[model samples]
Target chain A: MWKWLHPYADPERAYQLAGKLLPWFSILALGLILTGTIWGLMFAPTDYQQGDSYRIIFIHVPAASMSMAAYMGMAISAFIGLVWQIKAADWAAASIAPIGAVITFIALFTGATWGKPMWGTWWVWDARLTSELVLLFLYLGVISLYASFEDKVLAARAAGILAIVGVINIPIIKYSVEWWSSLHQPSTIKITEESAMPTEMLIPLLINIFGFGMMIGALTLVRFRAEVLARNGMRPWVRKLAQEQGAA
Target chain B: MQFESISDFFNMGGYAFYVWLAYGVTFSSLAVLVFQSVKQKNKVLKQIAQKLAREERLKQNRSNNESKT
Candidate 1:
C-alpha cells in the first residue's frame, strides 16, 4: 500500500512532482478566488444586520480557516519526519512554517478589521481570538526553532517537536467560542448542520475557501521545491539542475 | 448587482474602508508571498550554480598546475 509512495520520498522525484502539480493549483486558485471574491463583493446579498461590512467575510473566513488547516498540514509533516525520519517530510514542515505564519497573520488581521466594525473594537482578549493569536505564536516559534540550530538535523527535530506539541492548540482554537462565552460568533459554515448563511452568500464563500486551500497548496509546493534544492545542494541531481537552470 | 451605481458599489454601503482595507492588505500580502517564494528558489539555484562554477574553475586550475609541474 505505502510502497507506491516510497518513490516520491526521494528528493528529486518529490521536487519533480511538486513542479508538475504547482501550475494546476495556481490556475485553480486564481480562477476560484477571482470568481468567488467578485461574486461575494458585488453580487452576494448583504447581511440583514452587518450589511456590506459582511463583505469582508468573503476573505476573512477563508483565511481564518485555511490558517488552521495549514497548521494541521505542517504538524502532520512534522509527525512523519519524526517517526519515519524522512528528510523530505522535514523539509515540507519547514516549508509550511512561514506560509502558515503568514496565513495566520492574515486571519488575525482580517478578523481584527472585521471586528472593529461588528464588535466596536479592533481586538478583545476573548478565548477564540486569544487562542488564534497563540496559533500564530506557535508558527513563529517553530520558524525560529528551525532557524536556531547549526545542525540541520537538530533544527528539524526541534521544530518538528514544537509543531507536534502545538497540535493541542488546534482543538482549543476550534472550540474556544463554544467552550467560553466570547464576543466572537460561532462558525458560520457548518459541516453537519445547516450553515447560518443563506445559499446566495454561502456559495461564493465556499468557493473562496477552496481557492484559499489551493493557493496555500501552490505556495507550499513552491517553497518545498526551494527547500529541496537548498537541502540537496551537493547532490548530483541538484548540481545538474543548477547547471540546467544556469543555462536556461 | 447589489449597488445602484459604480460609486455606490465603491462605497460598499458605508463599509468600504473596512472591506477594501482588508482586501487590499490580504491581496498584497499574498502577492508578496508569491514574489518571495519565487525569489527564494531563484536565489538558491543561483548560489548552487555559482558554487559549482567555482569548483569547476578550481579543478581546472589545479590540473593546469599539475601539468606545468
Candidate 2:
C-alpha cells in the first residue's frame, strides 16, 4: 500500500499536482460563487417568515458547512501523517489549519449576525453554537501546537496528535442540534428527507456550498505548495526549480 | 428581481444591516484569506530563489579561486 502511494508522498510531485489543479479550482470557485450569490440574493423568493433576512443563508450555510468539512480534511491528513510518517501529509495538515480556522470564524460571525434577527439575540449557549465554538478553539490549538516546536517534523507530529484527539468534537458539532434543546434551528438541508426549503432556495445554497468547497481547495493547494517549497527548500530539485523561476 | 426597486434591494426588506453585514464579513474574510495565501506563496518562492542565487555565486567564486591557485 505504501509502495503504491510512494510517488505522491514526494513533495515535488505533490507541488506539481497542486499547481496543475489550482487554476481550475480558482476559476470554478469564482464562477460558482458569483452565480450562486446573484441567484440567491436576487432571484430566490423571500422566505414566508424571515423575509430577506434569510438571504444571509447564501453565505452563512456554506461557511458553516465548510468549517466542519475543513476540520475533517485536516484531521484526515493529520491521521495519515501520524500513521505513515508521510511528510506530504504533515504539510497538508499544516496548510489546512489556518483556512479551517478562517472558515470557522466566518461561521461564528455570520451565525451571530443571522441569530440577531432570527433569535432576537446575537448569541446563546445553544448546543450547536457552543460546539461550533469549541471547533474553532480546536483549530487554534492545532495551529499553536504546530508552531511551538523548533523542529517542524516534530511540530507536525504533535499537532497531528492534537488534531486526532479533537475528532471527538466533529460528531458532537454535527449532532448537537438533534440531541439537545437548542435555539439554533435544525439543519435546513438533510441527507435522507426531502429538504424543507423549496427548489429555488435549495439550488443556490447547493451552488454556494460547492463554490466554497472549490475555494477551500484552491486556497489549500496554494498554501500546501508553499509549505512544500519551504520545507524542501534545501533539496536539489527545489533549488533547481527556484533557479528556473529566477531565470523566468 | 425579488425586490421592487434598487432601493428595496439595498434595503433587503428591512433586514439590510444584518444581511449585508453577514455577506460583507464572509466575502471580505475569504478575499483576505485568498490574497494572503497567494502573497505568501510568492514570498516563499522568491526567498528560495534568492537563496539559490546566493549559493550559485558562492560556488562560482570558489571555482574561480581554485582555478587561479
Candidate 3:
C-alpha cells in the first residue's frame, strides 16, 4: 500500500516535488482568491435581511471551513507519521500547524466582526464559537509541543499524538450548531441537501472556498519544503542544492 | 455592480465596518502567514548555506595542515 508513496518518504524527493507543485498552487490560488473576493464583494447582490453585512460570509465562511479542513489535514499527516513512522508525514504535520492556527484565528476574528452587526455583539459563548476557539488552541498546542523538544523525531512523535487526540474536536466544531441552540447560523451549504443560497451568491462562495483551500495548500507546501531543507541540512544532496542555489 | 457608486460600494449599505473588517482581517492574516513562511524559508536556507560554507572551510584547513605535516 505504501510502496507507491515510497519515493516521497525521502525528504529530498518530497522537497523537489513540493517545489515543482508550488508554482501551480501559488498562481491558481492567487488568481482564484482575487477573482472570488472581488466578485463576492462587488458583484454579488446584497442579502435581503442582513443587507451588506452578509457579504462578510465571503471571507468568514471560507476561513471558518478552511480552519477545520486544515486541522483535518494535520491530523491525517499525524496519523500517518505515528503509524508508519514516516518523517515526511511528520514534517508535513509540523508545517501545517502555524498555518492552521493563523487561519483559525482569522476565522474567529472575522466571525466576531460579522457577529457584531448580526448578533448585536462581538462574541457569544455559543457552542460553535466556543468549539472553534478550542480548535485554535489545539493548533497552538501542537505547535508549542513540537517546538519544546530537542529531538525533531521525538518532537514529531509527541506532537503527532496531540494532533491525533485533537481529532475529536473537529466533528464537534462541525456539528455544534445542530446539537445546540446557537446564535450562529446553521450551514448554508450542505452536502446532503441543496444549498440555501441563490446561484449568484453560491457561486462566489464556492469559488472562495476553493481559492482558500488552494492558498492553504500552496502555503503548506512552501512550509513543508522549508522543513525538509532544515531537517536534512546535513545531507549531501541538500548541501549540493544549497551550493547550486548560492551559485545561482 | 451591486452599488450605485464607488462611495456606495465602499459604504457597503451602512455595513461597511463589519464587511471590510472581516475581509481585511482575513486577508491580512493570510498575507502575514505567507510572508512569514517565505521569510522563514529564506532564513533557513541562508543558515544552511553558511553552515555548509564554514564546514567546507574547516575541512580545507584540516586537509592543508595534513599536507604540511
Best by DockQ: 1
Candidate 1 structure quality by residue, lDDT tens digits, B5-46 = 999999988989998999999999999999999889888988
Candidate 1 is scored at a TM of: 0.97
Runs in model 1 deviating more than 4 A are: B64-69
Cα lDDT tens digits for candidate 3, A41-159: 99999899999999888888998999999999999999999998999999999999999999899889989988998889999999999999999999999999999998999999999
- Model 3: lDDT equals 0.91
Per-model TM-score on C-alpha atoms: 0.97, 0.93, 0.95
lDDT of 2 at A66: 93
Rank by DockQ, highest first. Answer: 1, 3, 2
Q: Fnat for model 1?
A: 0.72
The DockQ assigned to candidate 3 is 0.71
lDDT of 3 at A25: 93
Report clash pairs, candidate 3: none
Q: For residues A1-248, what per-residue lDDT tens digits would candidate 2 score against the true structure?
A: 86887998988889999999999999999999999999999999999999999998888899889989999999999999999889999999999999999999999999999899999999998789999999999999999999899899999999999999999999999899899999988899988999989999999999999999999999999999999988988998878777777444
Enumerate residue pairs that collide in model 2. none
Error of 2 at B48 (Å): 2.2
Off by over 4 Å in 2: A1-3, A246-248, B53-69
TM-score winner, 1 or 2: 1
lDDT of candidate 2?
0.92
Clashes of 2: 0
- Per TM-score, the best of the predicted structures is 1
